[model samples]
Target chain A: MNKWEDNKAWFLILPVFIIVAFSAVIPLMTVVNYSVQDIFGPGQRFFIGIEWFKEVLSDGRLHEALWRQLLFSGLVLLIEMPLGIGIALLMPKKGWGSSACLVILALPLLIPWNVIGTIWIIFTRPDIGLFGAAINTLGLPFDHTASPFDAWVTVMLMEVWHWTPLVALLAYAGLRAIPEVYYQAAKIDGASSWAIFRYIQLPKMRGVLTIALLLRFMDSFLIYAEPFVLTGGGPGNSTTFLSIYLVKVAVGQFDLGPAAAFSLIYFLIVLLFCWLFYQALQAVGTGDKQ
Target chain B: MARIDLNEIRHSYKPSPKSDDDFALKRVHTTWEDGGAYALLGPSGCGKTTMLNIISGLLKPSHGQILYDGVDVSAMQPEERNIAQVFQFPVLYDTMTVYDNLAFPLRNRNVPASEVDARVRRIAETLELTNDLGKRAAGLSADAKQKISLGRGLVRSDVAAILFDEPLTVIDPHLKWELRRKLKEIHKEFGLTMIYVTHDQVEAMTFADKIVVMYEGEIVQTGTPEELFERPEHVFVGYFIGSPGMGFLECTLEGDIAHVNGAAIPLEPGYGVRASSLGSRFKLGIRPMYLGVHSSREACGELPGFEARVVGVEDQGFCRIVTVQFGGQEIKARINDGHPVAEGLCWLTFPPEKTKLYFNERLVG
Candidate 1:
């Protein structure tokens, strides 16, 4: 009668193990094999233990890219979270208007990442685009091609405009999930609007907000295509992030050993940060409950 | 404390209600004196909760004037009316400590910290939640969370009234009576007007000084438990307020006697005239407890009764309920455990003082 007393159930998971071995484990092992070797053409290679890792770790270019990536992700989160919540609150709650709003907001999310970069790049051309021309007319020296500051601003703005709708959609779903009784009770309790939001709406939205946070962090950390198309890691390497540098080393120069080493370190950093974020978010409800 | 009055209140969720059936609450006009504990008792969909929400200013009646001490507050919000309410399920701020949850209302109104602390402590001690005050509300058991909700409502001194919508429903069966007793104690100590809504008659009877019975969005009978038990003004009250309910038997009455199944039976002395005026649609209503039963015809001589055949006997621990057939009609009689088990013939009687007459669902006698 005891289900866990028998160990035969372990065999049921053999198919899952085999699939993971072929899909994830094998590719990971190949990367691991390359990270420790100095590969010069397909056949000319020598095992150089830890040398590529040391080189990738010490390179100042990798260090600069990591810093830029962190700053970009942090700024993306800071702008998107509150703006998304505000938009969600402002959205119409019911009727055909709500559907229309949802469709409009989801349009950007449906577009391919590279297409988004292309659209923004064309839209920001001062000579031919309305957005760029309006800023030039406003007498702000706004050219992404020549200035690093302008380039950062354009990339940050593009990222925010593209991703904020996803946050809003998540927050709206969370808001709708709240029961009506909580709001009625709050009104009876003489709660101000802020108190109602703080105690009721925000707490109810915590689960979705945490999901949104983790998704934004991971996706923005691994972002490559959109930035690569927009700036091409150029204008004096101002917006060069980890993913672009990794791609440049792996595909452009074809330095397989050093790029493999860089990728392994990059994977660990992403894994470590994501794990930390997940833990911190989960602890919000549990730690404060005591 | 203030006298609360609902004047000609009626509500319909439909915008263009054309008939009585469309309204959820119809033409309610009643007043509750300040500091009185009252219960609104009814079945589900009887609009008791709707009336409570209207009184607490959560829902405005489509046609009514809700007056607090003669001041019309029909358009005021719940907070403006200064009321507190406990819902069917406990609604505590889950992330807050019990102390903070209790202190929220006071803190919202910008009360001094010392006053908030003293009030919170007083209510927590009363609700037996002092030890758990420092603990997070989300981590506590359901009943403990419910106690925190009750404490939050009670902690504020400026509240006009407190409403409870089946607050004891989620509590364990054994704790229900204990919490009911605690609520009664709190009611007496505070002298605050409390409106408790519930579908269970026993809960209403035990807790409230006045029980308002509602049916089909209308107030049927409002009386003390004794009055409701003894003289139910409406037929629905007779059926809803008692276990096993009152039984009705078709009958025709002349001056001082009634004929049932072509057999003559004397009516109660004072009720004969009122009973005689009723139309042919008359019924004699009596509780099963008051229906007299005897094992043989010789047991009751010359008293007008039914000679019936015993069908079944249900021994209910302390009492026996005997079901009998008379004139092709089925009726049950409750007897004490000492009554002998009857075999074939039995006599059923209606006590003159206890029996009542109804004409078209309205009590006549």
Candidate 2:
């Protein structure tokens, strides 16, 4: 008999498969089913074919939300990656202070997304919040409630504060993995500090930085709660992300047909981008390996 | 070429060295001739590596100065000192090809393309890495990567001295011999000053023209390989430089004879009196290769010789090592394979001419 002829071994994975099928596949099928039909109310439905998809494609709202989401994700990555790397570089290599710094950095990451948004919302109130009071005291008009530009800036700052630590922590782990021998060798080679950083530290961190970039891009593109709590999809929707917009369509308006269609489109877009990222990362990794 | 001078160099990591116990490295004053091969040999945690790093300008001395051809270079950076260092493990750029790894330092110095290619190709040939030059370093095995590291160091001829910190530890056993021979050949061809640090006695003995034996941060003895083997200045040196090491037994100095466990043993002339000024703790040191076995009737003098009980025997192809208990102490004796010896009681003798005496851990004669 073949060595792997024992089919009973698959029983071990049955529970996991069942859980994923119910939680992921079943829900996905329900959404697909809803996308093909128009639901007027509970128990009232009609086949709509691809009409909802066409409508969503030409909506123009999606185009605007996509543009905004892209800009937001780009801005978050640009600001967070370098700032995170810089903070990690400045951290002590080892000691009690390292543990202390780690705890302090992890605190923000552990906070619930909604709670973070609520905290920022209360903290940016011009009337009562310390930051808002300080800004107002400086004789500058800074109200995220009424100004679109202020709302955008507030949302961006809130995201940076809440997520920069994740990038920093990952970068720190990458940096720490590099052995001291490389640095010693570089020193003997007469490498300048800039050369050492550019050649050694940067190349060594490529793996971790790629992961950080992909994660930050996906999270920022789909950001909902923080911006929602801070501006409630913004002062005139200036800070509205794709996720919040989708939630509004699915729950607020209760248009299950259009909402399911919109969600499928959203999922496809994310999947496409993730696939692109994975390909790019594989290219870089294999190129280096060669 | 430069004659490096280390003038009264001392270092202690502690803030205050209240007594001799606090000094990580005691005061060491030495000089190296221009274009010489030196090996710093000692056990782990001995200050051999520390001294090498100091010479390479990685560590500043707590006191004194390092001078290269009469120019003070104590405060200089390693790059400024013009030294090439090979680490214990390979430290090549994993993202770069083997050729690119060798080309890095040359590019940093802005060397012309033709010269860089010629030099890199030459060192690659010496290291026997010509075929794999185009391959990425990450795909290569550990030994190949280390060979690349060695090539990177040797490619630059302008460096004042090349320092190797146990560079062959990652190499294969068979490759280590070939690499050491190649390094010896390269040193002969280039005539560059080389300082090799290793705890392995064989590598140091074969590679260095002058072996500097360090113990507890002090240069116990610095001499030619022959001098180190024939006459070790410190007990640690005698113990460290030989395979199976030198066997030492605690003894007392009584005039010209050394007494161990009430057994009188003859010593080389001018042995005990020479160390009389040094302190009380005395011991007799002898290499196993020199310690011989003799039948009771074959003995020549009344000088103490032990009828030792044979504990074990090791056949080392060319010779046999017999572990024997003499005067309540276990000692190893190297005998020719042809010698008739058994696993019972055997008479052992310490030849006076081959014996060394130590007083307070310092060699007497």
Q: TM-score of each candidate?
A: 0.95, 0.91
lDDT by residue (tens digit), candidate 1, A1-290: 55557787879998999999999999999999999999878798899999999999999999999999999999999999999999999999999989998999999999999999999898988877678878998998688888998889889888998999999999999999998999998998889999988998998899999999989988899989888899887788999999999999999999999999999999999999989988987777766544
Give the distance in Å from residue B58's predicted Cα in candidate 1 to where it truly belongs: 0.8
**Best candidate (score: DockQ):** 1
Q: Over the true interface residues, superposed, what is the Cα RMSD of model 2?
A: 2.3
Interface RMSD of each: 1.6, 2.3
Residue B308 CA error for candidate 1 (Å)? 2.3
Candidate 2 Cα errors over 4 Å, as ranges = A1-8, A41-51, A94-104, A122-143, A288-290, B15-22, B278-281, B299-307
Name every residue pair that clashes in candidate 2. none
lDDT of 2 by residue, A246-285 (tens): 8988899887888899999998988898888878876664
Worst 10 residues of 2 chain A by lDDT: A281-290
What candidate 1 gets wrong by more than 4 Å, as runs, is A1-11, A288-290, B252-259, B269-278
